[model samples]
Target: MTQQNPLPQEDQQVTLISVRDGNISVTSARALVVKAHKIALKIDTALSEPPAWTDEQSLTMIYTHGERVMRLRGVLREQVDTDRITVEPVGEVKEGDRRDYRRADVDARVYARSAGTQSPTEARAAQVALQLAPTSNAFIPQVVNISGSGLGFTAHEVFSAGELIDLRLVLDQPAAALVNVIGQVVRAVRGEGDALNSYAVRFAELSEADQDIIVYTVFSNHFAAEGLSDALDDFDE
Candidate 1:
């Protein structure tokens, strides 16, 4: 089957998985080029780091854009460079089901408290302290965007990958509410200007009520900004 959706944009984040002899390995990488039937990925390290890749090894890649998840299966091809690898799709690109809550771009304040150093004991203690005194030593970061599942924001402090965090999303206008949730850091990249780091986080366990509020806020803002409220209403009819 031919591709039904547009090609993924360059530099989109992707998770690559390789399985060999019952052992599986996964890595978070970026797409260098997305084509009709192939994709080039920017490899950050030698093949040995994530275990060696043999010729024609079957690989699976999952990527998300906005709210859509795409799953592509292909066989590894020639290595373009020490930092690049190519793969040719085995079949048509499979688009996952649409997310119930779409991501929305919003300028808001995010109050975050890092779980602190890698020491598990220290991290747990810090987490408990924060829970006891929520706003005592929080970092007020600027939220770049958010969705029901996760969010991205710029913070002055660096947050290590896999760190746990407590977040309070503060929306001030149109709809005002303080939504508190816990999340884990997925990735962190340096941001422009002095000392700013961009962090992507995936929400951890959340109560049903909190989940509903986040979904409602994101959808509301997205529709208002896109002027899609009327279109949505027409569709509902």
Candidate 2:
């Protein structure tokens, strides 16, 4: 299939998805190489453990490069080795435009409170009220990664898709502060066995100042780790 977006960069972080019997399994992986209509992935070693895959099963690969997020559908082509798998694209690569603010992989602690208790009409109005009020029923979830636009985290509770939630994130670097925002759940993939379910949520009605903090923290942390000042300038441009 034809893709309007540029090809994925090598070594970019990717999430592989395989669905069977109505259950979707997602694994963290990386793109080894990107070719026309195909890509090779360094599969996660855990794939051998349980819920084995078959050649007939199709896969969805999601990855972010720069400000674009691409979700490509493909079928397993070959198992290159115990750790590598090749896949051939089955349809046009789906691309989504992200905010100028870049995403940084982080393991920071996040507390979230579901607004599911409120009616749908009320929830829409509540999200616009600005500050997120702390609640005794708040859940401390592990934030997988974050960007100005959205964040992904893992939680034991299965938060239904389209649910609205309030978040309070504590940042440790580039000046520590608490960030409060309302977000909508975009996707929730349950992990294998008893593992926590992973959720991807998109921020909604965030103030410009709050977004600046998220962007600065992400860029600061990322540049500090990579030690690449040039890339920082490029990101600003």
lDDT leader: 2
TM-score of every prediction relative to native: 0.48, 0.48
Deviation (Å) of 138 in candidate 1: 5.0
Query: What lDDT, from 0 to 1, does candidate 1 have?
Result: 0.62
> Between which residue pairs do clashes occur in model 2?
none
Residue range 1-237, candidate 2, lDDT tens digits = 853765556775565656665444545456788898678888644322223566746876666544355667788888777667788987676764343356777545577668764354455466556454433245363545888688998876668788887666766554455676677889989889989788899976455445545654565466556554344232211
Q: Where is the poorest 10-residue window by lDDT in model 2?
A: 228-237
Expressed as tens digits, the lDDT of each residue in 1-237 for candidate 1 is 854754556776455656666545555456788887778888534211334677688876655544455666788896766556888877766774444346888756677777546454555455456543333345363545887688888777677889877666665423455666667889989877676788899876444445544554564465557654333321111
lDDT of 2: 0.63
For model 2, what is the alpha-carbon lDDT of residue 193?
A: 98
Clashing pairs in 1: none
RMSD of 2: 16.5
Quote the lDDT for 161 in model 2. 84
Per-model RMSD to reference: 17.9, 16.5
